[model samples]
Target: MIAKVMRGQDTLGLLRYLYGPGRANEHTDPHLVAAWRALGVPDPGRDPDADLSVLARRLDRFVRPEVRRHVWHCAVRVAPTDRPLTDTEWDHVARKIAAAGGVAPLGDDRGCRWVALRHDGAESHHIHLLATLARQDDTNPDIHNDALRLRDACRALEDALGLRPTSASNNTSAPSPTRGETEKAHRQGLDRPSRAVLERLARRAAVASRTEQEFLDAVRSTGALVRLRETGQGGPAAGYALALPGDTAPDGGPVWFSGTALAPDLSLPRVRDRFAGAPAAPAPLPAAGPWGQAATAVGELSEHWDGAGQGVRAAGAAALGDVLTAAAVAAPSHVRQVLQGADRDWSHAGRPPVGTARAAVAVRMREAARALSAAAPKGQAPVGELAVRQALQALAGAAEQVTAWYRSCSWEPQERSARLAAEALRAAVGGDGAQPTLNFTM
Candidate 1:
């Protein structure tokens, strides 16, 4: 799940849009799954004017009297899962929001007037929220660090509901990308440049290099410029920054980022640890079936993604075949694990089927394969679309089986793992330009 937050004025205008009939001339309608006032007595289901009047009255109590900027709007979107959440599940989500946002339920300090609406658009499920920032005592609730708090809350819910934890839930060190930084990249003729490429190269270099000079050289070889910051008066270097030569900020200034800025794992201390004889990156488990082959194929596919040739279109297509072959090899082991119960991870509750694990691996592998197959070799046709669909269907079947087995075990690690696998599969099969959403899963 992903949550987006926006703060603004004009509470009534936004409220009208949220509660009014669907968008201009659109026939589709959004379901008002949940709606309630935190401290007020007005039912939000009343006429639009009444609803807005109540919402505005509450928001006007905030320290800032600017009605236009008195509201906070947010939306949470979840990827498709085995089945839609039940009413009971949705109620839990509402309660979670209240608790996470630091709103008092029944007290002198009860805060926020909010409602949640769910939409089943092309994207499976997403909920919209429009809320006042003022508290019952005509004061603002301290929402500082609310985003971080909400993320933690969502992770807790992910565990409770057996939903796959998202990247935000697992983030502990790296700061999220900001609007300015993203816009800068856009101005540089880049479309969501892959930070993974940078981190992967840095990691490989750190593992391969013995000295700082070698490390710098290794990074430079990857087309990234390394700028080392030193202490005053020629003292030992204090830190380093990296920048892409061809990519610059909108103002024509080079945009440099630190290791931690790229990813926490790439921080200098972490990289140096690998150089200081710390254990290398974790290897795939023994039962990871075709993982070895898939990894190799992924490496080649990455080359295509990184602009390996003028005709990358062709290289991408050929890469897909290699990716599929890797998935085909890895699928069986996952299936085998499900058929015969085994302890895959200590966190898992009951012994989950191998098929669950297989589905996860298979989906990720297929996504990589599909990405690489963007451009088939000169005269070589890629795998048939029917074959790809069939393989995906089989993986989905295994996932459904796992889900059914754990319908009543939301808190179980096995269920979480199954959800994670399904999510990974969904991401993998998500069509052209599809790249796996990198996240640290339980």
Candidate 2:
């Protein structure tokens, strides 16, 4: 499996992404340190100067096409498989990167500092890249000359190595998007935004809670003329939103982003309703049935959730549990209990930044457990032993990642580290239970 590690504010997010819902310093692992040195990018997380302010300036200059806020950042590490890479393969990979115009600034390294590094992990040999959105040459520098050459070389290299090309072939047409061409296309195929759109533009936009659900609900409420419905689960898991008449193309009609070429969950009808420019009624509150009632409801859904009602029931219970938990935690001492609830019981012996992450994980775990328990019928099993094994394996992974988040923390990443630890703990807990018990009797 290929994994992408996206980071924001440099050291601020690597832990959470790698380990799970936690903070981490750049020097999370010794191998990673060697990897960074091998790559040649400044290991800022280890250095004293790499504070939030330094990150602020860097992000402003890098990822933010808009005004930089809170070090908005992302990085993707592409490693295809877990086979041990021979020297020849590693060199070939390095050569391919160099051939692509991304050269290493540092000398005598296993991988180029600027381009990529092959990481040694359980799954595969993957490339770790820490990059900003900054372009090397903004002035349309000889696109035909350098770019064409780079693409051709890359294609040749991939073919030689028995690897698949990102696109079909080098003979494919070039990407020439002139502004004039876009305008012409607009004129040819379009009508103006409907009159309904004009009135619905927010007279005043109000920002709501930064909490994920609140933010998602806010976006969902936007009755765009075009919209994608949440599938499987709700919130982010339900997937991305495309508010047509809003998130839609400026010229009008459906316009999904990058790879969403197929029909999305957001239906055209839903978009039209939102085009009226009013918030939809909130999703109904979860029915506060008795524990047994809720358990039965959960069981019923889990058993038959697939095909007809897969994520629908799981998501509903998850969201309902969240509302209940959040409502219950506001009282005195409730916060501290969350911290103690999952303290240093695991190998690491310290709670992940047990504050912000606790609730988030709780909601997810309870939902999943309920779904699993509910899914297994009294006699008939829709899922097999393999499926249970797979689920457990996945859960183990989530737990490990959460542990990694805490393990990776360093002094420089103090705040972010704390935050990540908390989040990871929450996710691990949310994945299953805080005080999980393992029995060898089986």
Candidate 3:
């Protein structure tokens, strides 16, 4: 479950909107499932005669006229895959949210007044909670750190209520696409948001390059506009921003997104760490081609994960993404799309949770990535079917390891991504007429 909290000054406006049909007429059967003190608040949705103004006024009656933004609102939403929660279950959830926010404490009659509203028709099961900030005794409730508290409460609720667990509960996933980004992508006829596109490109560059200059060159090679932020005039770049050719802001300037804005690991400093103590290029491959060499290196990476410190494990996960991206770049036309899909999914699966200590790049896996990048044919050199099969098999093994690791940590989003990537790679291997074996033990 996830909770979004907002504050407003207009209690009546919020109440009316909650009870009325939503902007898209998506809200159905809008009615109160729970309210403060079991106060017998009138249900405007069910009771045609019940005035919304009356309920709003009652909720706000204890607040001083000078109290700005005294109306507290929170929306609690369950995962789409979770079973539908009954009104009774929703009431319990709303109460827990209220208590967590310090809006209304359990068993405290004098606590702030609040109401839980439920409506059908949305894709996900959700409830809206509205509360007045002032308590009955004229003291205002403390709402500091409410978001953190609500997050913790929801994690507990998911386990207690047997609901589908989510990565948001532990804040392990990447920053999700905002509503604005979604709408913008829809308007532009793009398959995904620009942020997502840029993030993928940045990851590919970070993995393929051994230095900042090489990283910039790699990004620009993809037809993305690059703007470097230098520490001083004519000095080395401290950070950089990227934008697609046609993506622009309202002022007609380029719509630039900094590396950090995409993900913490994409930040310039973090990207630099990926090449720390690394060779500029990989060692020459033996008679076996780059694809075969990368496959061997990737197959051996699981050993580093076992009995490794957090940093080493994190580096291994990240290096796997590098290898996937490199393979995607070098893959034959027939299997390139599948490899790209795996690369994209593995990007999320490989990211260390925020605040994890930066680790040195996994040397062997990074070398594999560099070799794959270096070996990519400049012309239309025919790619061997056997090489493609071997690469897919190695990628599948790495993804399975990632999935098991995330599952052990109870990180549902990363685990799901890794599992999906593994499935895609295995399917591709099968399509190439190879019965790939993943030997990694969880």
Clashes of 2: 34
Per-model lDDT: 0.48, 0.31, 0.78
The all-Cα superposition gives candidate 3 an RMSD in Å to the true structure of: 6.6
- State the local distance difference test value for candidate 1: 0.48
Ten-residue stretch with the least lDDT total in model 1: 339-348
How many residue pairs clash in all the candidates, one count each?
17, 34, 0
* Candidate 2, residue 6: how far the Cα is off, in Å: 7.7
Judging by lDDT against the true structure, name the best candidate: 3
- Order of the predicted models by lDDT, top scorer first: 3, 1, 2
Cα RMSD (angstroms) for every candidate in the order listed: 14.0, 20.0, 6.6
Q: How far off is residue 349 in model 1, in Å?
A: 19
Q: What ordering of candidates by TM-score runs from best to worst? A: 3, 1, 2
RMSD of 2: 20.0
lDDT tens string, model 3, 1-442? 7789999999999998998876655567888899996667998888899999899899988999889999999988775435788999999999999999998888888899999999764344678999999999999798999999998888779767855444464444555445456457655668767887898889878877888888899999999999989888787678888898888889999889898888767888888877876786567785667778777778777655576666666777888888888888887676778878787667567775634344443677787888778766541576656665776777787778878888898776567667778888887665357663422211
lDDT of 2 by residue, 190-252 (tens): 332222121122100111122334434544465533234455565434334333443335577
The local distance difference test score of model 2 is 0.31
